[model samples]
Each structure stands twice: as C-alpha cells, then as structure tokens.
Target: MIPVTRELVTGIKLTNYKDFIVEHLEDCPKEDKLSRLKHIWSMPKFGQLPKKPTKLKLLEHTRAYLLYLVSTTIFVDASQRSTLISYLQLLRDLDEAGKYAWGAVALAFLYRSLSKVADRESHFSGLATLL
Candidate 1:
C-alpha cells in the first residue's frame, strides 16, 4: 500500500472543506429549524412515513428530507446547539468586503440547470404523462 503524506491529507481536507460547509448550510436552514424543530420537542413522538412519488416532487422531497434530518439529528441538545449557532453565524457573516472564493455561486447555477432538466418542458426522455 502507498504511504499517506501530510500534504495529501491537508490538500484533501482543504479541497472539500467548503463543500462540507455548504452542504451543512443547505441541509439545515436556521429559521426553518427554529420554527418546525420545536414540533418534535413538543410532541416527543414523530414518525417517519414513506412518500408518494410525483412529477414535480424533487424540490419538495428535498426540503422535507432536510427538515426531518435536521430535526431528528441536530440541535437536540441546548448546550451543543449554542456552539453550533456560533459557527453557523460565522458562515452567514462572511467577509464580503474582502476578496473570497464563492463556491456556492457555481453550485447555485448547477442546481438551476439540473432543476430545469426536471421540468416538464424538457420532457425527460421526450416522454410526458398528464395527471
């Protein structure tokens, strides 16, 4: 087996760190978590059920899954949540005045294009069925 070097490890982490941050930000929106997450706290018994597939279901499914994952896993403890809140604030409060790499801009454009492909206008494989 090939030996691992410090440079290799550091480069791998540096290359993917922004992606990790962006993914976390996308997965958990603070405002929505604050509002809907409390429902779990109040009830203390929420169940997960299978979802029905639909033509325009991709975006909605993504949202619901993100909410469920966030509520079920993150912010379950008050003390840990405070630390998480500080780090999230740092991401939100980026130094826009200074020059910085904006990877999310490229991701946003990519997401828009992929969403267009999912639209009925693109005709996914030139096939269409009306409900």
Candidate 2:
C-alpha cells in the first residue's frame, strides 16, 4: 500500500471545512464519486448543475476529473511550496512558476489520497504529462 502522510490528511480536512472525508468514506453511499465531483465542479457562476453540459461532451469525463482533483484537494500555500522547493532543489524540471504550478497539482493528489476523498482509481493520473 502507498503510505500517506499525516500532514496531507490534515490539509484536506482543513479544505473540506473540517469534514473527515477519510473517516466518512465508508458511510457515503455514492459509488460514483468521480461523477458527482465532476458535476459539482462543472456548475457555472450560478452554482447550478446544468441539464446538459455546455462544454464539449466527449471530453467531459477528463475535464471533470481534472477539475475534481484541482478544486477539492490541492492547496499550495507559501510554506508548502517552500518545503517542496527545498526538497527538490537538485532537480530542474521546471522554473519557479512552473514548479509552483506542478506543486499545486501534486498537493491536490496528495490531499485526495490522504483524505480518501475519492478512490485512488478515480484520479486524473495522467494530468501532468497531458498538460
């Protein structure tokens, strides 16, 4: 099993208004959490789910998955980015802004895993490469 850190879990809890998403996973009956998450994020400025998505229907699955990960999980505050930068100092995969962008995406996944917000199987796994 992949090891999840306590900090990651706490960060997610904070984001979800102290809801212990990990602890409640067993009770939540929604089997298709990914679909629900997609619907949630796809809502527009009025914050209402549309009868039919206005955007491209074919790519909705992938788009929803990415928004799900980005909106619900990832957080990159100053301190968090600093720590990542320090740990990955030797590598030069991205410049400052690029590194920060990647860090934000990574933190989202880390939060999702630690909080058990959605099954790991439901993640947008190839997002970084595709982007």
Candidate 3:
C-alpha cells in the first residue's frame, strides 16, 4: 500500500482535486488569498444538509459533511474559512470510500501538520484533539 500523505490521501491525486474544483467550483468566491492550496469551497455552504434530499442530493450532502469533518478536524489548515476540495474526489463513490484506510490517512495528515509546527513556530491547525 502507498504511504498516506496530506496531499495524497487514499490515492486521490492532487491534480485531480484541482481539476475537480476548477471544473465545478472555480466560480465560487474565495475568502483566503494567502492560502497555498487553491480551489477550496466555503465552509458555510456545506454546513447544512438538505431537509428533503433526493438520491443525488443526499450523496452530495454526505460528501459535504465528510469534507467538513475531515478538513476541520484531521487535515485542517490555517484557512479555516474554506475546505480543501481534494477530499471530494475520494467521496465521489461512498461505497468505495470505506475501502480506504481513513484512520491512517488522518494520522499521516496530523503528523505532517505537526512537523510543520515543530519546524517553525507556526500555529497548529490539525487534529488538536489527538494532541
């Protein structure tokens, strides 16, 4: 199995994530201009799920929820206002999503973030619960 990294979670390529966002959410307004990662979605947009959602809508809602969960918790960055669209590629097929080692990925991301904090006196933004 490939080692998990912040950018390569469960085989979802960074380029694909960028492509997905550019194709889908490029028009969406971004609040953080200093963020290194591009193509992020506003957190508030995915804050709630539809009350009466269709099949497709339900899938989208679940995806949004998972995105929020991971971004804010495990893979969080300094820009808390938006979420990385990279994880959306993995959420595209929920059934297959379970096959990925999510816990390992989260651990990897946390380690990576911690390393950044240790290397520099930067603010910690990932998995504070685990610390």
What TM-score does model 3 achieve against the real structure? 0.66
Model number with the top lDDT: 3
Task: Give the alpha-carbon lDDT of every model.
Answer: 0.31, 0.31, 0.60
Worst 10 residues of 1 by lDDT: 2-11
Across residues 1-131, which tens digit of lDDT does each residue of candidate 1 receive?
12222111111213333344344333333343332233333222223322664533443344344434433332222222222222232233233211222233223334554466678444222112110
lDDT, candidate 2, equals: 0.31
Pairs of residues clashing in candidate 3: none
lDDT of 1: 0.31
TM-score of each: 0.22, 0.21, 0.66
Candidate 3 Cα deviation (angstroms), residue 40: 11
Candidate 2 per-residue C-alpha lDDT over 1-131 given as tens digits, one digit per residue, 9 for 90 to 100: 12233222221112231132222221222333321222322344224334675543323333333333344333222222111112122121222223244444454655554454255554343223223
TM-score of 1: 0.22
Note the residue pairs that clash in candidate 2: 74-108
- lDDT, candidate 1, at 100: 24
**In candidate 2, how many Å is residue 20 off?**
33
